[model samples]
Target chain A: MSTADIAGKARAPWMALDKLGVLIALIAVAGTVLPFAVFRANRIVLGEGLQIPFALEALPALVLGVLIALGIAIALMALSPLVKLVGGFVLLGALMILIGLAATGLIPPGDSFARVSPGAGFWVLVFAFALMVTDALARLRLGPWQRITILALVGAALGSLLWAGTFDDLSILKEYANRAPAFWAEARTHLVLAFGSVAIAIVAGVPLGIVLYRIRPLRAAVLNVLNIVQTIPSIALFGLLIAPLAWVAANVPGASAIGISGIGLAPAMVALFAYSLLPIVSNTLVGLVNVPETANDAARGMGMTDRQRLMGVELPLAFPVVLTGIRIVLVQNIGLATIAALIGGGGFGVFVFQGIGQTAMDLVLLGAVPTVALAFAAAVVLDALVEMASTRERAR
Target chain B: MRAGLLIRLVVFALLVAFLVNPEAFAFVFAPLASNGQPVIYNQGSLLDLTLNHLMIVLIATTLATLVAVGLAILVTRPFGAEFLPLSRSLANVGQTFPPVAVLALAVPMLGFGTAPTLVALFLYGLLPIFENTLTGLTGLRGPVTEAARGMGMTGLQRLTRVELPLALPVILAGVRLSTVISLATATIGSTVAARTLGEVIIAGLLSGNTAFVLQGGLIVGVLAVLIYDGLSAIERTLSRRIGQRARA
Candidate 1:
């Protein structure tokens, strides 16, 4: 066969089957077959819950039109690469809007105590949309910076929507509404725990790292200890800290005055600090050791003292790597800080455990979504900072 | 170093003995009490808890390694090159999302049991192995592969005999990291009703008993250290072998 004939044969089948065809089909099947929401009387009780199944025939005219548009977008995915990409995003956005509309419409404002939350069908649709977006972004072949920019823009748009009370009618938002003050307070406490631990880690870790680097004999022992410390589960570490801290609070004259306690910020901060140290310490040692020997010699030739050389030459060279470690520690601490709640340290984990206890999924999501967002945002921002620092170093 | 290893071995033996018969050490914990009563974490056998913890971690890490290595192999091939970014981001999502959140999200679909914990552990363990496998595979020397090809070896043979052997050290490093991480993370499985060492810690938290917490933490911490050392030794041996092979 000629090359043209072969190309046609190859392209035809792929063209007929879009990249996101399977996800769209899954969403379609789930939306048709499953309940969209469950109606419950009040948040905590699950008795006599009514399932509100999804039916295209039952949807309002506007929602039906949107669904039709989404279907068209899915159909258009097989046409061309550009069309497929745009169609994928359109399908995603349309599906989100449909979910919002359906949620608001199905749950009347008059019935305040009767809660309507998302069901399995809603989750499947969300998953399908996420898959569609991921596939589209991959096909787009955007650079990392460009992709991050798009992500930030989308995030900003979503934040604005949320700020504008767009999703206030949702059950999750209702949960948030009930505990608005506590949510903000817990968020503040979470930030304090994460940043406070990171700060302590830097203070302790950097000096320790320098000492380890300067004293070769100490490196292995120190790293081994830190590695072992790191391998202890966060919960366990928090647990381990409680007795010692409580003892200090009771025995030490001024300890309780400074917020030292068995179950609260003190042990939580200590655990987080311990967890953050390994990354910072290892990255510092690695960064310093990897700095070119020639640079140090040149600094020495320039009549620089050891301290001066370290501050001016070595640290600048190693800054990006050290920052990378800090970035890792920061993101890690954000996630770990959630565990502070389990210890009565008062972060987002409060919502999570409380939700589990009460069997309220919305409460769990309230705690979880923000924690994930914070971690993701921290990573993205720090990655950008590291990139910027490295690029500047390369330029120099 | 020998003495250290010997001490570690003894500690491990003692801990195992204590776990198998925690009541034997009840006197040690008797000094610590909460609510005017001596604290005893006797809800389950510590031996069973430790075993279950190990099993969950092993299963999760094994599945993670398989999937991660498979993805790495796929994306290293010419046809799957386009999926590199997609796969990387997917793995990043696995790490960026906390294990607790994963457990929380999973419990609804999988129900509260080993299944959700396994899913959480598997996801949490993915990124380290994925990144390491990618680095190991992509960092393979083109000259070595070319030499293997020149020897009239097929692509599969070259990969199996040359590439994988050379990449084994790095892959082992990845596995070591994943295993260590999963070991620590598996403790959280108790929250989802999975039998794990975390149960002791959780019970201690609820009952205001520091002794139970210490007991659980000590076992998990020591287990982590031992396993970490074991894996590091294996990695060191593999690297030495690879080094010797390269010199030859």
Candidate 2:
């Protein structure tokens, strides 16, 4: 045989071993040897709960099948590339099966008041499997659209499982059972509080930004004031608003009629709006100022009025940057809105504060999961919109 | 500039006076005080509370800076480059999850008080420092690094004597941002039974004592501004030094 053929034959054996796959296997081994789960009663107090030790021998046939699949996957990593891909799929499938079993099967059917929460070891396994899947996908070099599609499909599958009563016995779900009706109301309040403040901030901040940009003297003063406003803690800002708003509600004609009060939604909205102003204003100014001189000249040469040039040229060019500012403000407000519950403003924060007072981890998760999910979703959507806008502009 | 500095100093002095003797500032908050209610937050010593608040912020910010900067350094290295996405997502998770939620979640594992508060603050403070550290390290001048290499400096030497010194200003900006944020957020730790200025504010809200709320807010706000200004000055000084060195 020729030298090339001989080299290819020699290299084939070493190519089978996937280094990251080995790491994943090691983590899985650690996970299997540690405490796999915690057994808790009700949603609140964790009193004298039993720690379920993980045992390979004690696992049912289905779980054992999953563990064996993981082992086989590690072995396949050193084999053919196609086999490596199969191993990845097998690991992902096993993960899903594990989650399903933990959520539904691990706890007995009659233990409605109890929860079988995944412990540190289980979490480590989940993390390792996720990392392995990500590594495999990265190796595949999938396009962004394909990656997102796969992620969405996986998310939908998990969501369906949760919706189909598979995880109804989870402690977090039990907390939801108690507040099922009010949950929708609080979610609505949260959306309103977040979006309403963003709208107000944009309305006031954009014009102020334009004015500041046009007037050199006002820029520093306005920006510095806004900077200081941003530095105030959300809680402190809410506190600061109480007196002035209370005064306005008491003294101003029709203020209380318009819902301007010391506590609850009004002050919360005001604080969020104030907190949102700096980023939007600064971004607006920056975007407007950065519009090319050539663009302005081109608009002027076309016989456009100053206002027309601004509307048609400057604003359009600046739109993406301003959108970025809005994205930051929107995501920020979602997280900040959780603090409003502390002031008796109805939102997820209500659940959070209630959970803390009651010392109920499940209730806290009930509030927290949605809040984080909403923030992440808002950020992703806004980022996608910004990307679309910029790409469209570039295409033009 | 001198006049501005004078104004800041006066403002800081007044803040310290207020913190030292909150009753002295009672008249300023008198209008917000309700009938039959005390005009000042007297249940806790304002000085002690302010110190405790600052201590919590200091500890949290320092820990966050060390961990975030260390992680950023690791991820920027060629060996750790593949973990960048993982580290980034972890930081994003911290940012997306509200500090209140962190406190609530942490309390179960860590129990009530300073430990949970510290955990929440550390997580909340991570993003700014990590982003800044990454930016600072990655944004180092190519020529400067090449010069260091040409002089036969080893990787560690180049990093310590060249890259880090040059990147100090940017990294300090992150530290400043994290510190200011922690200072403000530490107030919320009181809600979880952590000793903080927020305790006064929460108590005020519950009792309709606007004066107490104002007092707590005013102290926290002033402290934040002072810390921000102080850090900005240091950042400016560091940048100026770097500029002078470049010229040399």
Candidate 3:
């Protein structure tokens, strides 16, 4: 009914998460119950013609009822502070999330309910996140506040959904949540498979790129390898790895059973990492090469050594661009990480594969939402890092 | 454009090694499978897979070019000066988020198949095409337009005859980029039930077969990159023709 001012520009952090705001927290609690209500509450719901049931039922209710209602209330309130105007849409989105939960009925009172899986709750949040993102991305006629508030809301919606496992099946979450030790086992398994291979890629790719760049004879050779590597399909790449890695593991110490545990994560990470190398390497090469000819000349004129010029002038200037490459790689890695699920690597792919296996739309969200959200979150974080690094360079 | 002699030798060696040696093939295929499980290669039948992948990427790229080129043209009109930043930012969003997310969201509506994959690829391809097209069109000089008008060329004539000829190279580069990315991304179409080379990779992943994955990955990757390079060459050639005429 009423609007409020955001914190001062001097207090940027206070305005960020809005720690004091409860924000559909009640709905989150209700997440454990919305399934029954959704199944029960039908205004003769017309399902979306070409959608999964969860989306089919939930989107219109939220868009038509909540998003529109809020759109109108704010439409009339011209005097609403700029921050609240954006935040109002966010709150409306949060409210619609509550309705979405009820509309989808993620947490059913009984099996008799239309009985979308628990993951429906998460998808509700995902839909809200999409809504918020679309809203944020729409345009900002106002100021930094509008963009910040809208973007923050989109982030918050996505984060909360992931945190709550709203987009996934309850069975897996409950199983994982209750079976903490097994979850840990799985977690360690994934962390190792995912992080380990990616680490290997970073180590190998950077030097390889630099070496290739520096050596005239090797540049084309290495670049061709890079290009070839860039082109290899991850599926094919993974398939290619299986035989040798298996041979090594079986014959070699402690390696044979690595990917044999029902074919999930390990191979996926390997394939993903292989895919990751090109962007990192090429970007680094490009960034390094892009050094102004004059800048290099100046370093030479100043009597700097090659190493000094590289460390002092080139790497620093090129750091931003190289990091931009890394950023792209990292975000790409997150998406590819989902493919690791095909190999049983875990992360968000579990739900996706499960969805495919069970032929249930709800189960798919278990993997899909998190995969999408994780990729997006990674993109945002890397984006922020890129902005910070570039701005710092500019300041310098 | 000729590479140095030693560099050329290395390239030849790598090409020979990859095309000939079983060991070199191993490097390419090792990661595609797991547990010696024949995980990759010949995922479904070959023809269906190839067709699916090609269609998805090709359709997406074509659609993206149409929409992006149209939008770019509109925004380059005289009245569009005030909105350049906004258009640029929208294009950024096309690249900013993960394309996988776009595919996931699209899958539900379009159903799990090539349609969803096509949409994802289209959105993914949109940014590069939009920006390059915009830059190419907007980079036009006032004198060129004045000369066209003095020569009594109509608006459409000016756009199609003069501006398009000049902007073709830059625009084609964008098309090349978007096409290569779409080709790689056609792999994701598998999850949505759109057949492609991804089936081979996913199979290898499931079966733990590296060779199959490698085979598919290598073929697709080489094909995509070479195509990209070839397109780039075509762009260079076009630019040179225009460039030579301009110089004259």
Q: Per-prediction TM-score, please?
A: 0.90, 0.90, 0.70
Query: Top model by DockQ, which number?
Result: 2
Q: Per lDDT, what order, best first?
A: 2, 1, 3
lDDT of 1 by residue, A233-253 (tens): 788889989989999999999
All candidates: DockQ = 0.55, 0.57, 0.28
Poorest 10 consecutive residues of model 1 chain A by lDDT?
A: A47-56
lDDT of 3 by residue, B1-248 (tens): 45544554565455445544444355454554446544224335454566667777878899999999988887776655434555675565546445545666576458777788888899889989999998888888889888999999997899899987888888888898788778866786677777777776665445545566556665566557566666766887888888733210
Shift of residue A32 alpha carbon in model 2, Å: 3.9
In terms of docking quality, model 2 is: medium
lDDT of 1 by residue, B109-138 (tens): 687778988998898888899898888888
lDDT of each residue in A1-396, candidate 3, tens digit only? 223343343444433332112222333333323331223122123232112234335564445345434433433332223443465556545543444454334444554323333233444443333333343343344333444454577778756875765533333343344445644564455445545665777788777767766876877667667666666655455555555556666676666444442245556666777777887787778878888899899899999998999889988887888777777776666666655655556665555555555544444554555555555555556666677788888897
**Over 4 Å off in model 2, which ranges?**
A1-34, A47-100, A106-112, A130-155, B244-248
Which runs in model 3 stand beyond 4 Å of their true positions?
A1-88, A100-108, A111-113, A116-199, A250-266, A297-303, B1-45, B78-87, B96-107, B110-114, B138-158, B200-215, B244-248
lDDT of 2: 0.80
